[model samples]
Target: MKDAQKPDHVSLNTLIMRLREGQFVIPDFQREFEWKPWDIKELMRSIFLDYYIGSLLLWKGKQENFNALSCERIYGYPKGNGNPVHIVLDGQQRLTAMYYAFLAPDVNLPNRANRALYFVHVDKFMAEEYDDAFNYDWLTRRWSKIIDNPEVQYEQHIFPLAIMGAGGWELPNWVQGYEQFWKNRTQEAEEAGDADAIEMAAKSTENAHLFGEHLKGITEQYQVAYIELDQDLAVDKVCDIFTQINSKGIRLDAFDLINALLKPKGLQLKHMWRAAASRLEFVETEKMNVYILQVMSILRQSYCSPKYLYFLLPGQEKPVRDPDGTRRKEVLITDAQDFEGRWHNAVDALQAAIKLLQHPHEFAAISSKYLPYVSILPVFASIQAHIKTIQASQRLDAQRKARHWYWASVFTNRYSGSVESTSARDFMDMKAWLQDDNAEPPLITEFKTRFKTLEFRKETKRGTSVYNGLFNLLVLMGARDWMSGNVTLADDLDDHHIVPKKWGAEHLQGKVIDTILNRTPLSAETNRHVISDRLPNQYLPDLIAENGEAAVRSILESHCISPAALAILLRDPFTAEDFEEFIAERQRTFQEAIETLLVKERLDLPVQLRELDEQIEQIELGLRKVIVAVLQADSQYELPSHILRNVKERIQRAAKKNAALDGDYYDTLEGKMEFCDLRELHDAIKTKALWPQFQPRFVNKETLNIKFGQLAELRNAIRHSRSADEITRKEGEAAILWFAKVLK
Candidate 1:
């Protein structure tokens, strides 16, 4: 059933000789050579030991469907061609490694272009035992002085693996010169009075002769095994045989196949894609292939995806990429010649789309790092390319529509599935909206209102789409630092909590700290030094005393707080009861701020916003009682000093684990430790294993430990700048009710 015959044997010299003369070619379907230096070293070692590495699989074909360029690509290759070119279907990695190690002394890998061609010296190393076998340990791709040693002679010490064919250079092997070097080394060692060196030199002399003879036999006589498939086979059949026999498990990629297809037609994939992509500096070559294909599809069929680049069109009766096969439009370009002008426009449109995102600076909230969705770019570019010139009046309307789509897409997790499908639909939708005069964008308000999932989650970075959207929204509304006067920059901003996590953890079990309602963007420098886990209730007034109330309130309103909400939160000795009310009130303002983008209404922020000072006073007294109970349960004498000392130890331990979590309390131990707030005392106490001390009195150790862990986790979420909005909502009320039970 098979067209190919049994395996055949060919000398390494003969094989390379054929390769250099363009007699051998690598098929486009094969993966790029991926052997590292270790692999090369091992392969050479096996060959020197005369072990059977493997046979090369050659597909002898009448003609290639792809490029003939592949035929001329053997390293150290001569320009002339033989009658037929054999495609090496297998053993490419091993063959490439051999070439990199022994031959191709001038070729360099792309990254290390300045380096000399790879080599390994046989008789180069001298300090150790004189063995005929070359050490394959330092198998570096780059050249070194050791590999280029003057003592090494061709077919003797330094072996050349690549030079082959009629036109190749051959360096003569010197037998007498190798003997003279060892004799000279022996004389020098004798004069130095080193017996070991003398003995090694004499041994090197004998081994050099043996090694040289062995190298000569291998290069001149030994054969490298190979199998050549029948030339009468079809391209697809050859491909199937190649794939079935390939040991390296490299799958066929679209680009390689496409290049092969284009090569016969005198078109190069790299040249065509590069000419268009170099105009735009941001996208890389591999991605450019995708862009070009998408553009060509849009130009030809007006329906495209990056997947189109690899699809076998015009050749295959039905080329497939998408699970749902891409439907070719009736207007598809029948030939490649008709496709160029359209591809150029697609390139220009892609560039224009990037510019459109940057034009008014409002959209600059996204950078390459936090793009949220990359497919959005090319799809948007394609849509904008089809449209007429925009009127100035229509720009605002266009922006509103774009924003609605952006926010809705992010919050609703629209593109989490099939991006090409989503992009196709979105592109069509935008095209429809851009054409219609009476088009109204989807109500962002409805999306936000239906969004029950808008809760804070702890994350190391702000790369998520939701985080990106929220940051852009805050930037849209002028967010500023409460402590400093400077406008906040996201790069320098910290998502800071308003109510100190430490105090909330103590009184309210530290729940609700990571909520977007609690977290506001403040300058990192101000947040680090000013807010430092101290509640706004206490810190705001302290700041107001130093800097006037007007200065502080201005910054709060910019964070989307109403003046009334700010006043309620700013109350002195703000308690856990007041903390609950403050979070509830602040959440409402946040909602109103989001709604402003859609409806654009002013909220009537009443100045007499309820401040529960009496309830706050009662909560503070109750908290002091709880602290006194916790401390006195184990120790009754000099309770204030005992509490202070215990809290100091807890602060020192937490500061050790992560100094950032300490809120700069590490800088001044006496200041942080001496007569701090009840909340601070609670945080310090919670850090220690104190439930055993309170065992059988208030709660058991297990219950106390669980309660303490939940509270600590709440503080941890804030300390790490993670989301705890759900914790705040879930645990805030329960903690307050538990405290209410404890107080009763």
Candidate 2:
């Protein structure tokens, strides 16, 4: 009945030797080695930085212990004569990672295709850039050359970590050799009288010696703590010991820590989480529990990182800025009653947010997987709660604005990183924006800029925000089932290739065929049975015959495939060229849909006006390219004198006022071209000196004037953020189409 737990430590040098000799074995019940290359690289970094990597649990092994529980040699350990003395109960991942990295095993890491070699960037290590110092790469032919060549490794200032397991004289010899190598280069540079090369080589030599000593010191002196169990302990007792030790050692995130902190206040955060868990089960994320607290924090103090979440505990006071813009202290939760009330309110708001998100006509995030940004949930829910408190009539307008913000956040990836500050700022801005027309969140302007150039042709991944946003757009568009020709539930649809992947692989070599532009949500049955492994031309003709062209085209249009794109799809012997054209046409369709649906003004414009607007944008863009080319050829890329005095000066003034406009000359010029109406383009073209260079592109100044005047009238009306009258739309359509054709 003696207590079996004993504390122990081992120098890293001895530990590496033991691992190399296979003296310690892993228990068979242990999980498989799953550390990625990055994870292994991080461990190396921690060891080099002398950070504590936590304690290992070892059970003293005997014949009975081995017989009771099976054991295996550490993964990738070479066969050795050394006998196993201990069973690893914990730290298998760390040990295996060390074995893989220090030993540089011929075997690959788990789930990896190629063997990996780990290296320390000596310069980075010496400079204390620990995060960038440790690295690993597949032992490909290119890397093999670098690994085998000492000169290349030294030139790159990378020292391979595998030499540690070589034992005894190997590492010291490498250190000495590395220093001498750089010293020789330094001497050569001095002989050549190359000041820069001498300085560089001298630094390398110094780094070499310093890094060698530091690494050697770490290997010899670094201590790994462990808990040793007596050999006589029962297997059941060992299991219990492991469970207790591991459970205690597990790190607590903000939610778990806050839960523990709240228990003494007579508030059971765990019980509350259990009750609210079912409500948030719709989203497939473990962070939902933490998100509830974040929502509460965001609602209270407009900040929700772990630091702010601590203030939500009972009796915790956080500083706040009032609605009237006065700073004050506010107790986030006064007591258990107030704490519970806020918690439930936050949970209820999140539930309401999820309902709106999954609504087909709203964000159309029918499933958690298709939801654009889970990180946006705190702000989303907080804003939803804010909307409810406003007047009922105003709530609808407020929700419309909120929907715009949500889509903007998703498409622009605004909430992807450092969500705490972003959520706080956005929540405050959105509140202001909802109450006043002039107070628009900066994210709206960002989305306008980013969305204009968002290349759907490169969005090939399912998990990306843009990819998911596009799929959700399809859901909102009421993308119909291809086979049934009926609008289908988003849950029942899976994003499938418009052009079968099998055909693209065969015919469209080197083409990116899986872009969202070439994919749409379709029923699984339709993908398998109807469109199975066939080109769109092969299947669509049959669909058109069955459902008739009108009905089938309507279904395709719902998926954002226009008639022009359909024609490209229906092209016989659909070539890669056809695929490119189809994607281009669909890109335009999707872009238009986003503008009409998400980025539209408060008042909807006529479809003809929207189409005319798109046409004008394309025509002006093409005209700018022509103008830039002509100007570059004529003025050697210099801004024309008139433009420099007028448009350039005006833009520079604007950029001075708005920091967002600040950039280099060419950037400012591009911004000028993008923002300037048809008037500026006309002025540049009609200028006395630049007229001849632009004359060949147009018939004459008279013709140019007529077209420019037509476009200018409509552009002014649309760019003013209002719907243009019918006469302006008609004239603009004619002029835009003419210019679009001329530009093409």
Candidate 3:
């Protein structure tokens, strides 16, 4: 039996060629294709990263063996004579994934509704972001066209993997075409004198060449190992060998290996887990087992990757780095007792963190499904443990800071990619913040800047972090059951539609009717009996009749629906326009609630600066109305010739530099005013012709110019995202009052 012998290697290019030619075949006994799309993406990523993807076991098939075993072509392979040379014994899943990705056959994945296609993001690949470089999409008509269109592919910086499997000069030709496409674009940008576009296109051209070389390297050099059994070997012997290989129990992960490694050191890692399992059972994720180890590593060395996790073993030295990276040392784990202590501490901390997540008064992730990011739990638990160790008076403040961090992380999708490094960095940043409140992490500021513009309408899916986090927010808001009028119990709540799905489907055509703006937490019973298949205008009156309007309004307020939104819902005509108004009003209410409860001090600006900022906004509004009215008072609504020549030309030049102003610049006079800075508005007013129209309101251009200058200084401070000094605020306040009186 030469069954267990030395393995030979085949390059990926050769393997793909063999697959296309139907040289490799699967025996009838092999399992059907079972890999998921994400699994296929990971395989592609590994191949690109040049990581070992294990080996294949094959039986060298003769005519007699092929006839006896009833060999079949791989799924999605064209049916033909096939002229099979080998029958696969192992690695069916990997080989099939490669075939599905590279070949991109016209078939849906197993048990999936839509056909899938794989792509490589050339920009991400060139940046060495292997995890995010590979992606797949449903083969809809739109995606099909996108993959086939070379211009669209170049614009998006993605490369179709199927070209590689097309087998001849197709890949190299496509790569060359991509490089030339960007080179031409760079030339066009240069001709247009757009420095930014020129830089972008030139960088894309360089990346194209780099990505092409990388792809060529992977295809021609990446190897797959395989062991072949002789054709002369009997079928019974081959069948027995396959059974022994496939009958293995559970596949080992890092945790299992670590458990065994700890046993010889007198640490029963498995026994500790058995003891702690009951406490963590409420989390309902298998990953909780390894998260314990990850948390331990994070608390010890501020890193939880596999390489750092190994340092937790007894007598293993963990390299410690100073903040400045100037000092470093290896600190050994003292003993098994020390390991056990860390394990227990991690367990306790994780328990506390889970309780906080499920607590209605805390982060309010009601259940596993409602948890915005399970991947963030390890760092979260470590932070919670640190909070407990602080002084009693400071613990509340520390917990509040932690809560802000959690919400910011959830909303920003901070843990979605490169989780290990992100977790470590956040842990370090948060630890610093907890000790010194002035050193807030960057995510809190990011959340504040983006919170107002968050597109709640796009959050239509239930399982995404933003969707689940919004639901959790409703639960935390103390959403009440309509019929029962009690606080919503976590386990009993469902994200039910405020506007019944049936009514919305009929009336809200072309609108995203299932957005979070239209959904809120309600008990299953309330959703079924109270609000079933009825509009809010229809069911809300019934609720008000049962409970008084005041109580019902209070209940609605708990769901972040303000009195204004309630009025919109209770409109008599209640057309689709009212529904849209209700959605907008409720979104505004949610923004207010989020600002008050979570992002209390986004910029941490002083109260005086905020009031001054609002004053400046009011002054600007007055100026815009006066300018537009003066311009439109005669025959047509237009800027005066001199003002247009000076102010409009300058604003248009600024628009070219700031892309955000392009749309406004091309619009009407009012739209152009929206893009105008305070100084530009002052320029228009101080123009010789326009000064006659404004002098009556302002009394004189000299005072107008001085007050406008003060307002401009204050506006500049606010726009540049900095606080005005006390002297500037005093002068700006005087100018605000002066303008308000004059405009009046």
lDDT for each residue of candidate 3 in 493-568, tens digit (9 for 90 to 100): 7788988788778888755688899998888999999889977878899989988999998889989989999988
Q: List the residue pairs that clash in candidate 2.
A: none
Per-candidate count of clashing residue pairs (backbone under 3 Å): 8, 0, 0
Ranking by lDDT: 2, 3, 1
Ranking by TM-score: 2, 3, 1
How far is each candidate from the true structure, as Cα RMSD in Å? 22.3, 12.1, 12.9
- At residue 437, candidate 3 shows an lDDT of 64
Model 1 per-residue lDDT tens digits across residues 641-691 = 555676676556544433344455433434343335535545534444553
Best by lDDT: 2
Error of 3 at 666 (Å): 25
The digit string of per-residue lDDT tens for model 2 on 550-650 reads 99988899899999999988889788888889999998998888887788642234555566666777888888888777866754445456655676665
Give the number of the best model, judged by TM-score: 2
- The TM-scores of all predictions, comma-separated, are 0.41, 0.55, 0.53
Off by over 4 Å in 1: 1-302, 305-348, 355-361, 364-366, 387-396, 437-461, 489-515, 532-534, 564-584, 599-744
Candidate 2 Cα misplacement greater than 4 A, ranges: 1-251, 319-330, 508-511, 601-744
RMSD (Cα, Å) of candidate 2? Answer: 12.1
